[model samples]
Target: MRFARVRLAGALAALAVLSAGMTQATAAPAGKPPPPGSEMRNVALDTKPVQSSTYEGGTADRAVDGNVDGNWAGNSVSHTAQEEQPYWQTDLGKSQTLTKVAAWNRTDCCAERLTDFWVLVSDSPITARTLAEAKAQKGVTATKVAGTAGRTAEVPLHRKARYVRVQLEGTGYLALAEVQAFNDEVIASPSPAARKWVKDNPFGMFLHYNMSTYQDEQWADPNASPALFDPTDVDADQWAAAIKDAGMTFGVLTAKHHDGFALWDTAHSDHDIAASPYKDGKGDVIREYVDAMHAKHLKVGLYFSIWDRHNGDSVELIQNQLRELLTKYGQIDYLWFDGWGWQVPYSQVPYQPVRDMIRKVSPRTVVANNDHLGTLRTSDVIVYEVPVQGMPPETNARPTDASDTLDTNRTWFNTTATGAPRSASDITDNLARARAGNSLFLLNVGPDRTGRIPQDSVDRLKEIGSAS
Candidate 1:
């Protein structure tokens, strides 16, 4: 179940709050509070995680390990035995202004075990050995989550506290895949380069064409056989033409998604196009896509999932894959990364080295990381996924981009019954919203199993083209 950080699985459920009297809101994958200070820092990484009791091998340290992967089977969860009231808390070494607390649930199974929970902040030390005594120490009742159905969840807590705790009131086993604490709110500002990026690419296309396309599901299992990735008439040219006709300046293709199915043949592993029947184990979708984009004088971008359920993860693999994509394919205009910080925190795949690698290979390429953490420290252009986080605020702190599926289907890929494209008005409306929010809109249109964008989607793009 350790999918290469398969965020496409939709594990996070966010609930946002502002101070005590502000109206509480329900959202998906909320961000840091909007205040100026140090960058959004995960204070938990510097502290030790403690819980009431450990269940089996579920140690409290697992929750602070920077992995938001909700699959307990992957050993990323912190577990506490069935008790009257169980709790997990971490110390900040000193009193700090806490912005928000995020707790991940066990998604592999028994997610209800973490049903009802509360995120409490206390200025006083939570030194009490019992839950009652601990609750007394909590200075502020940050928020109490009624029940969790395993969706994207987070809350903004502008409380100053030395200790933060996630506790359950009823008797039940407590399993947390991960727990994260961020301090200071996010203040927005666009990097000089990011501003230029936004200027050049205000609208683009997102092609979700991969193994998930063959499986007819939103997300394919990590162990899905590569043999299923058999596209009879895959045409990257058709994709480029569609985007060009749509009046889009750029396009990003899913070179590899969270399922770890790389589109290009690589030395990293065999879980890619090389393993499929396409081109007789020599197919290179990245090559075809890049060349096609260049043919139409359109910018080329590649969507790379940092988490991998198939080939596994490592900095070496990432660097090698980047080298191949950048060098072999010529200049990649932009690189859109997924599953970082949100799924597998940057702690695992440190940013500086990867950033240096990209700079070394392609200095002009821009980065759009979907970490869901709104800080320019990571993304060159902060990406707001429409389905996950409705819209980027008109006051977005940094250069921004927004993404949403054109298909009406729930998932990102084509399924048994192909999805109809969203209405042109709906598509254009979001585009306007994106621009108002200082973002470029990258609308996803997944290609069907035959390796072609559906006629309906192409027609929709034409309609959008006319509207533009």
Candidate 2:
């Protein structure tokens, strides 16, 4: 029963000869078969991968070093740090109904973890396009497949595509072991019924918090000391209950703000609740928030800032912590991110990591970056945080649900402070306007120096709650 190596090749050759007439892509030659008592299941050695380059050095400055195998030598794409596009375009030789994308990790001996990645498909090669251009163009769609637990990414195919590209972007080094593309029928776009469901639910909360909250400021203030975090009445449960009472369906709290202060307990950095001054600082705000929201049957969201004010060397630290948050938390429904950051330039760096985290942690939850491109890329919904309401419908302002709707599905919602409420009528008018446009109204309440929701705000919420 022991088959020599040569016999395995021979067996593959025989299979290829038998299948040649029916299949377009040729199979590997039959060779030495499996050894005695060994089992090989579903082993189809048809297409072997060819390595183009290996980036082992810090940046892409060093020479590309790696072996080239199979047929992808000239067809391979080399990525230097200079090569802004981290994607490799490959053709299946003929038109293929690609159903899946298998990305191989080919890195030098020193390559670290992969920071992030995304898959883009088009009948033609994907050229660089701005957020604007990507929005305007059609036939180009991408799905984020990084930061997930698995390596294989299944892409349903509806239309035939000759060329497929895998774009890798993030903090880590780069290399591609191999890419296997499967063919199948392309998938149709989302239905109108799905769009309608999301549009009806308007008015959600957007919480922007960070270590600055430790300083009682929005963003990190360099002049402020980290020890300034002292809040006696920091009860997330109360916040959630207040939101629920006001008829809000979901609440998005800032897990980490621009100052990189994580609202929850984190293993990566020391800047978080662990270091705060609430109840000797043993509280995890995120945990309480999640528990409270679930208690109220309200959707829970975590807002993270891609921008960090503290040390920026820990990109890997950042991603690992995020993975923990998504996997550990029971059910996070949304991921909100900012575009501007200290480490990566917005234009140069892609938000694939954030998108990937959302997909991996909570596939059902929508992921939105600060840039409107979130609407174009991985986000199922669009959010315009503009305060002005009842503006005439424009293309940029058009709803994802309908062309005529000023605020339709994937629509805009207001997330700004409503100043001091001179009277209950002001709050009522703002709420009515938001409801009229079919948009969510997220009113901001600036907490007092003690980190307690202002009594006036609480009174106002009570008034609003009674009205709702």
Candidate 3:
């Protein structure tokens, strides 16, 4: 196979492929082809058994257990105490050329514990007992790979070796969901099908209708009486009709916001719609919303806030809520995660487990985190909330969406005082700008406390749709 050596300034030089066939192989009937230019094959699957420096509650074999849901954790304490570094290793049975190494971090909890690591490949047996000894070994090439919070670290190793080792750098703990080694093939970014769908449906509606809507607050107090969350005239069909009339292809409803008040009946939380007086404690807004969207043949999306003021920032609780949403709904198209900076930082949140659960339940659901950037490496789409300008510069490598409110003011939820709706020209201009930058434009409209969108916003959206 032909190869090219790529040397980054002041860093270790490694070989990379200049042509497409360097990692290309025949595809199985059921297997999809790798993205355009790269060929990737997972070589760590069902290979020789794996070994680790230390483990707790499980063997090192769990790291290569071929189960994305399972994980291997270090024996060190979960706190911030400094301790010896942890490591996991496996012999490939025979020396083989390697291209990339992907290590999945623990997603259920303690995701930030695994950070600043090294992927080492050696021809001889890896005899180093400690992390320092493993790094000091001669004739061994190593590539430093930094962990991305709760995402996989797919490090490229353009070298050859029979033994592969992953050693942690700092204190905390060493945990990994799975470790994979690829020979010559690299997975493509943002599948072509996904990209095309986003391009085709560039305009969607963001329905900010939740318990907070009744309180006229962006973030309602968690202790607010559940009886106050009463919508007199609930009409999911009207919301769907408004969006369809606006020429939007999809709609995202606030299923659960920062208040920890669920719009659907959740068995895990008593503070959900089922506990509220709406529909005599028997309402399921999510069900009506899903049915309405499906009847209109429009895609359905749900907004779930990661920060929970009432739930006390428990990782397992967040995961359980996500499981309920993903499984209860038949087929959700998008999942919008919001409220980042509250009690727990995004790094500490177990995003990978939630992401994995979403994939397991609804494989086609597009995941978007409100990182407030043009794009994020971990999320499928980057979201910009209330952009003053029409759209941000096209800097993100993935699809982007600019979400803003119809009202001129910053109010996300309903208010008694009505703000002037953006003129049809203004809405059209924003859409044009978003399309120019290859981004989706999500226009927000908050329904009143009585669960009905204002007439002015509906008329404005219809005007905007006709102008387009």
Best candidate, lDDT-wise?
1
* TM-score ranking from best candidate downward: 1, 3, 2
Candidate 3 local lDDT, 209-245, one digit each (tens): 8878777777788888888899898888988999999
lDDT tens string, model 1, 1-468?
Answer: 122343322222221111122223222234533432224557775378789999999999888765555556556678999997788888878887776777777666787888777777787766765566666653646477887735335767776777788888788888887677876633223457778888778999988888887887667787988899899998999999999999899999988888999999988888888888998998888989988999999999999988887777787888898888889988888899987766655656776678778888899989998876555656678777766455665644457888888877635777775567879999899898788867899998888889998898899899999998
Residue lDDT tens for model 2, 32-93: 32222111111112332222234432222111111111112222223434343344445455
Model 2, which residues run further than 4 Å from truth?
1-197, 213-216, 222-224, 313-315, 340-348, 372-374, 387-419, 422-438
Q: What TM-score number comes out for model 2?
A: 0.50
Q: Order of all candidates by lDDT, from best down to worst?
A: 1, 3, 2
Error of 3 at 36 (Å): 10
Question: Candidate 3 — which residues are off by over 4 angstroms?
Answer: 1-188, 341-343, 373-375, 388-390, 394-397
Clashing pairs in 3: 39-185, 39-186, 40-185
For all candidates, the clash counts are 16, 34, 3
Q: All predictions: root-mean-square deviation over Cα?
A: 9.6, 18.5, 14.2
List TM-score per model, in order: 0.64, 0.50, 0.60
lDDT (C-alpha, whole model) for all candidates = 0.76, 0.46, 0.68
Better of 1 and 2 by TM-score: 1
Provide the lDDT at 8 for model 2: 21
